[model samples]
Target: MDLPVGHIVTVLEEMGIFEDDSEPPFEHWLVGRLEGLAPGIRSEAERWTRVLRDGGPRSLPRREGTVWLSLNQVCLALLEWSNRYDHLREVTRDDVLAHVKTLHGHQRRDQPVALRSLFTWAKRQGVIFRNLTSRIKVGQNEYAVLQPLLPEQVERSVAAALTPAARLVLAAVRAARVAQIAVLVLDDVDLGNRRLIIAGRARPLDDLTLKLLADRLPTGDAGGRAPRTSTTPTRPAVPATTGSARRCKDRTPPLERLRVDRQLEETLTHGPDPLHLAEVFGLDEKTAMRYADSARALLEQDAESGFSRDTRQGGNE
Candidate 1:
């Protein structure tokens, strides 16, 4: 028994976790803005752990962020399903199919991927004879719909301080992706020569984009050639003592993930490969595909507008 049910129940009860049992865990997690997860879910201590840890060759692949976040959702679903059906061993294909169908379409793709890995492992352990997850289908990649705003309009929407616009502009104009843009330091920008060097390759920059970067970028050198090596730590500021926890919450906004509109970022992210943008930006493949599609749509719209302008000018002549 990986779980000590009494301790788990105590913590959840203290946190006022799920007074209503009607809601799905996914919706509850998002709606209640759950910042913490049960130790069983966070650690390798769930009932699924045996196969997950010891299924050597058939082990599920690990992923980060939204992809791996699917695990918590899956664990919650399994717990609920087991309770309703009397045990995990009693679950069938219909139970999984019915549960999966309730998911938002995008999650229907991602979460099923998580569950399929688990179910496959379970089948090898004689929990299920066949991989019942085989027939579940998810929708394909979708493009971000272009907003009615122009490039400048979209750019202005971002905080001048955060510089998402500058990030987007440089990536788009240089035929680069977000990872390349994010790694860029003052040394990468050659304002005097109108060039941006990335990984020893000199990419020519237009005056406007260069000016945008110049205004926002903090230079390390008097000659603007020194590299900036400083990086913000990934962890949030933790309270040092029990007394400071309230101070921490007061000083920082409680729900501050900075969820800015990425429409402009999507429109600007350009590359030949769909996965390239995703790899660069630490985004999922579906998001990367959408960004590429938005970029293409923007380019097509520009070309059409340019052609129309030419036609109107010729008619006037």
Candidate 2:
């Protein structure tokens, strides 16, 4: 069973291991643990242990707990695959790939990151001539299919929103994610120009969105001009909007789903062009392509169903 690094460190401290002046207690303990391994493997593991302990030349310093966690993952990988090679320098890209394939779920994803960190530091330190894990890719590729919410569902959700802030969140979902909405400040809103700067990109505000924003803004003075404040207030937390959606009588989709639905609507209005999606939503190329492909597939399916319906009608005539 695995124990936390803190527990292990406390136990070691109690044993008076830290009293020694020869080397750091953690490094000494790590080396002692790897004593059963081959000399070549143990030597490389020790190098990594020291590198992690000291925080390598190019890397930012990490806390003691973080250092131990990272070192644990890297050391485990090295020890497990020790039989395949005598030294880390002898390990090739194929060796790294083979090791990574043995892991499952989060381990499969995170082990590569640990390996990259180790090899990158090793290369910079001249311990290894090349970073073998540089080209290796992990994690999922295909995006999950997002079903757009119906127009009636959106209408009900809008009507159900009780607070001006909640309404603002619902309106902003057309352009920004929940995270972006949560961080929105008064400076990001341009009521006079009818635009909102979302994630550093200017999104044109629709009339409903504009009205919702106006509802949230402070009331004007007796002369009718809006009062200017020295400091801007941030929008409400994510829970504010999510709570509003949860309170709806009918099942309203989460903010993210609503955002996807809005994107699909945009694709339907314009065309399923990745470039257009990227510019409008400020999404990366890969994400834009995924959305574009999803929209295109949806359009094709609709066309096929329409053609089938036309054929059935002609047969009936």
Q: Compose the digit string of candidate 2's lDDT tens values, residues 1-317.
A: 57666768789999878554567677676766676666776787667766676766666567677666676666667876686777778878887888888888777777788788888877887779999998888766446664556556666667777776578777777678766776666666777776778888877665556666777676545543234565535533233565554453244666666677667666655778989878878989988888888877777877987743233222211
Return the TM-score for each candidate structure.
0.49, 0.57
Give candidate 2 regions above 4 Å deviation: 1-95, 103-117, 134-140, 191-194, 206-208, 218-252, 307-317
TM-score, structure 1 vs. true: 0.49
Residue-level error in angstroms, candidate 1, position 121: 2.8
Q: What is the C-alpha local distance difference test score of candidate 2?
A: 0.68
Global Cα lDDT for candidate 1: 0.48
Top TM-score: which candidate number? Answer: 2
Per-residue alpha-carbon lDDT of candidate 1 for residues 1-317, written as tens digits (9 for 90 to 100): 78867678788889988364567554444423323434333232233543343336655534334433655557656655645654445667898888887888677677787787767666776766788788788555454564333334334323232433433343233334433444555556665665666655665554334555566454545555424456443211111212222232222112111111232333343332556644443457766666566666755776787743233222211
lDDT of each: 0.48, 0.68
Lowest lDDT 10-residue stretch of candidate 2: 308-317
